[model samples]
Target: MKYSISWLLLLLFLPFAASAQTENPVYDEIAPFNEGLAAVRVGNQWGFINENAQMVIDFRDDLVWNQDADTSIPGVLGIRYPQFKNGRCMIQKLKVNNIPFYGFIDTSGEIVIQPEYLNITEFDQENAIGIYVREMYQGQNEIKLDIVEYIFTEVVVNINGEIVWPIMEREHALTAKRRYEVPKLRAKLIGKDLLEFKTEDNKWSVKKLNLNL
Candidate 1:
C-alpha cells in the first residue's frame, strides 16, 4: 500500500489544527481574563469565555438592551469591561423605562445584585465597592446644561449586597469631604477590616470604613 504525500502531510498537521480550535480562539473583542474567565463581545452581545475558549456564559443572558425594542440601530458599541474581583463582576442593563443601570454578577453568570444602581466599582476581597448615584447640582457656570455630582451615598456594601454603612447624607457627605485638605480623597485599598485613604494632603490615613460620621 502506497500512502500519498498529501495524506501524510494532512496527518502531521491534524494535531496542530485541533489545538488551534481550542487554544486562544480569536474574538472580535476580548477583555483580560479575570479569575478563570473573561468577558467577550460577539457583535453587540457580551458573554464570558473561559481560558479554554469555551463560552461559559451565554452572551445573550447578560447583554444590555440587546432584546429591547428601543435599542439603537447600531446598538451599544461595547459593554463595560469585565474584571472579576472576588468572584463578582460588574454588569450593566437597561431600566424598565430604558435607562442604564449597573449591577453585579457572579462567575457562574448569576446576577448577584439586580441592576439598579447608577454606578458601581468592582467588589474587592472585602466584598466592598463604591456605589455612586448621580445627583444634579447648580454650578458656577450657567452656560452648561447642568452640573452633575456623585454623592458617596451608599459608600460600601459587602459581597452579600448588604449596606455596611447607612445612606450618607448629601450635605454631611460633602462637609466631611471638605475636612480633608486634599483636593481628592482616593481610597486605594478597601479591605473589610479597614480602608486606606490617601489625600492630596500628601498624607495617608487608615480610617475604619464603617464610620458613623
Candidate 2:
C-alpha cells in the first residue's frame, strides 16, 4: 500500500493551523462612523477603517481624528470642530521636529498645508487662525522696573496664507495695557458678503469675508 505524502502533510499541519487560529484570531472592535468612515486604533497608531474592518487610511500616527466639511474647505465661515474636511485632515506631526506645527493632510496622507505655524487654534467665526510669536526680553529689576520696556507681537494667519487681521505691536502683548488707543476695530459681515471693518475715525474699509457656515 502506497501512502500519500501530500495527505499526510496536510493532516500533520491541520492541528497546528487550528491551534494558531485559536490562539491568534483577529479581533475587531467597530469604530464610530464619521463622514462615511471611522478612525480605528490599532496597536499604538490610529487610522481610518471602513465598517468591514478594511483599512481605508492606514494607521501611522500616535493619534488621529476626523474633520467635517466646514473645517476642511477653505473660505467657509463658522466654527469647525477638530476633524477632517474635503479629504484634508489637520494633524500634529513630529513634536521634536522643532516648534509643534499643525497642518492639513489629504486622504492620501499628503500634507496640503505644511506644518510651520506655532499654534493652530480652533475654528473661529468660519476661519482657523494660526499664531506665530516673537518674544523679546526686558531686564527690569524691581528698583528700575519702570525704566525697562518689553515688547511682544503676535502674527495671525489663515489657511489661505491671508492676513485676515493683525494685532499690531503693542496690542500683541498679552499683558499690554492700552498700547494703541485706537478705537476698537469692529468687524462686520455686510450685505455684499464682505467684512467691513469700521473705525471711529471714519476710515471705512472692506475685505472679502470667508463665511464657514
Candidate 3:
C-alpha cells in the first residue's frame, strides 16, 4: 500500500473532521466562525456555537424571511443568514406589516439595533446609519405603521439608539439638506468617524462624523 503526501495529510485530518461532524450531529446548516462563534441552523431556527463545540447560543425561533408587512409586529427582517463583524452582526425576524426588516445584534446575542429598516449597514465600532420607517404614535396609544404613510429616509444612529443626524431623503434633498448639514446616504462607518455612502446620483460620498461613541 502507498499514499501521497496529500493523502497522508487527509488521513491525519479526517478523524478530527469526522469527530466534529459526528459530535454535533444536530445542526442542519452552519456558517463560518466569526468572533469565536459560528451560526448554525437546526430544524428551521438558527443559533450560535462556540469554538470548543459548545452550543453557546440556543436555536429558539426561526428567522422568518421575505413576507409582506404584518401591520402588527414592531420590527422584522427577512434575513436568514448573518456573520459577525466588528463584534456585531445583522439578523432578521418574522413578518411586521407582513414584511421583514433589518437590525443588528452583538456577539453576546443582544438585539442592539431593533429590526425596523428594510436596509442596514454594519457598524464600524462607533456609528452606523440605515433607512427606517419613522415610528409614529396615534390615538389609543397604538403604533401607527404603514410603508406608504412615511417616506424611507436615512439617519445617523449609534448602538445606544441616539440619532446624531436628522433623517434625509433622496428626492427632497433641499429640505433635509437645510435641516441637516449633509443628506444621509446609504452610509456606514468605514473607519474612525469616517463614513462612505452611495448618493442618489450613485456617486460615492465620504463624510467625517462629529459624534462620540
Candidate 4:
C-alpha cells in the first residue's frame, strides 16, 4: 500500500518539476506562440524565440510594425507583430523614396525573398498573392491638370518566391488592376492546388497552379 501511495505522489509532483525547468526571460513584450515560435520584443527591437525560450532569430528593428490602433477592428490586420505562417515570416525594408517593401524569411532567419514586392499576403497553402505597384502621372494639356495613378499587378507566387502565374483579370487583357481596395482581389485557395479570383465581370474564376514545382 505504501509503494502505491508513493507512486501516486510522484506522478502528481512530476508536473510541478517539469514546469519548474521552463525558462522565463525578461522581455519588454511577449506575444503568443505561432507555428511553435513566439515574438519577443526587447527594448525597440523584436526577435523570435522557441517554446523553450531560446532565441532562434536575432533581434532586429526593421520588422513591419503593427499599429496598435487597428487591434480593435474586426477582420482587420491587427497582428501585434508579423508571425510565421507556413514556415515563413514577413519582413520589410524601405525603398529610396522611403516606401516600404515587404518580403519573407524562413524560420532559420534566412531571407528567402528579397524585399521588392509592394505587398504580399501570408503563405496560404504554399501560395500567396504578391502585388507590384507602378506609379504614373497623367497630364491633360487642355485642362492643364496632372493626376497621379497607381497600377497594381498581382501574381500568384509560391513559397519559393517563384511567380507561377501573372494573374489576368480579363481575357487577353494584360492590363493590371488599380490600387483601390486591393485586398478584395487577392487570390484565394479554394481547393487542392486551385486558386479562385474575381474577374472583371464580377464573376469568380478558378485557376489551377503548378503546385508540383
Candidate 5:
C-alpha cells in the first residue's frame, strides 16, 4: 500500500516538474487569446510556444512573425506562419524547392499538403485560392519589355491533402505604371474586378490578374 501511494505522488509531481522546466522565456512575447499561439523571440531567432509555456514549435527561420493584427505575430510571404480560423490555429507556408511554390501544414508539424503551385493562401473551409505567374520574355534588349501573365486557380484541400474539387481558372495581365518616379506593374483580377497583382513595369496597362477571384 505505501509503495502504491508513493507511486501516485511521484506521478503527480512529475507533471509539475515538467511544467516548471518548460516555462517560456520572459522576453518571449505571447499573442492574444484569439491568435491561438504565442511568438517567442530567443536571441536572433523566433519560434512559437503554447499557452502552457511549452515550446510547441521550435525557432527555425530568420524572421518569424504573426499576421493576425490582434496578436501581432510575424507575417512573411514565403515562410510558414500560423493563422487562426474557427478558433483553431492553422499554419501555411511557401514550399519552394524548385520553382516558386506553396502548401499548408497542420499544427502538429505534419505536411498535410504537398507543395505544388506558385503561391497559396491559408485554408478556409478546406479551400485555398492560389495564383501562378508565367513571365513573358523578349530577346536581348527587348526582354525588358516582356510581360507577365497571372493565372488564378482555386483548390480544395482536406486536412489530409486530398483535393475534393477543382475550380475554373482565370487569367489577367500586368502593365507598367509610374509610381513616385519608379516604374511598377499593376494587375487586376478580370472577372471579380479586384486588384490582385503588383510589380514594376514602366507604363500603365492591364496585364496581370489578381488572385482574389
Candidate 6:
C-alpha cells in the first residue's frame, strides 16, 4: 500500500505531537483561551500558556485573586487571572496598605506599564485612559485607611505606557449647545489613527493621534 506525502508527514510527526501533549504539566485548572493564551493554575500560582502548550509566562504566586469570588460551584475558578485583550493584559500589585495598583503587560509577558496607577481601563485599540490620584492621608485604623482629599486626573496612555495627553474634564467635555456629556473616560480609536470627540458646540470632532501602540 502506498501512502500519500501528507499521510507520511503526519505519521512521522505523530510521536512528537503525542510527546508534546504528554509533556504539559498537570494544572489545577485551565481557563479558556483568550487572545491566543490561556490561564493555567498549579496550587495557588497562576501562569499563561500559548496554543502550542508552551508556558510563555512563568507561574507566579502573587497574581491577583477575585476577592469576592464564591468557588463553591463546580467548574468555577476563584482566582481572577489576567486575560489578554488587544495583545495586552492587566496585572495588579498590592501596596503595603493592601491597596491595588494596576498595570499592563504585553503578549510576551513583559511589563509594558508599571503598576502605579490608582485605576486603569482596558486597552481600546491602542490607547487607554487611567486615573492618576494624589491623596491626602487622614489616618489608618485596623480596618482601612482614610483618604481625605483626592485630586484625580484622567489621562490617556499609549501601549508603551507613556502618558500622551490629559483627557478633558467631564464638565469641559460637556457641550454648551446640547449639554452632551462624555460617556466615560475612554478613548476609542477610529480607523487607523483617529480619535473622535464631541466639541463644545456638540459637533463631532476627529483628531489624528500619533501613539506608540
The number of the candidate with the highest lDDT is: 4
TM-score of each: 0.56, 0.43, 0.61, 0.65, 0.43, 0.55
Alpha carbon lDDT at 132, candidate 4: 51
Q: On TM-score, who's better, 4 or 6?
A: 4
Instruction: Indicate the TM-score of model 4.
Output: 0.65
Compared with the true structure, what per-residue lDDT tens digits does model 2 show for residues 50-151?
Answer: 556556667666233333434432222222322444445566654322323456666666666665443444333334444434445566777876343334
lDDT of each: 0.58, 0.48, 0.61, 0.70, 0.44, 0.65
Worst 10 residues of 4 by lDDT: 170-179
Q: In candidate 1, what are the lDDT values of residues 51-104, reduced to their tens digit?
A: 887889877545443223322221122224555778877677754235455677
TM-score, candidate number 2: 0.43
Candidate 3 worst ten-residue window by lDDT: 71-80
TM-score of 1: 0.56
Per-residue CA lDDT of model 4 for 152-177, tens digit only, reads 67777777888777785322111333
Alpha-carbon deviation at 81 in model 4, angstroms: 1.9
User: Residue 206 of model 6: what lDDT?
Assistant: 72
lDDT of 3 by residue, 1-213 (tens): 356887998999999999988886676778779779888887667788889978776675634332253323222232335556577677766433344566777767788777766555555575666676564444442465432334567777676656676445644322222253222345656676676777768788888777753
The deviation in Å at residue 33 for candidate 2 is 2.8
Model 5 agreement with the true structure over 59-174: per-residue lDDT tens digits? 65423244443332111243233444332233334332223344544555454555544444454454444443334444445656545334444433344555443433434322
Clashes of each: 0, 12, 11, 0, 16, 0
List the candidate 1 regions with Cα displacement exceeding 4 Å.
1-25, 61-80, 132-152, 170-190, 195-206, 210-213
Indicate the residue-level lDDT of 101 in model 5.
Answer: 43
Q: Across residues 6-113, which tens digit of lDDT does each residue of candidate 6 receive?
A: 799999999998987789678988888998999888887789999998899998764554546444411112235556768877777765255566677887778888
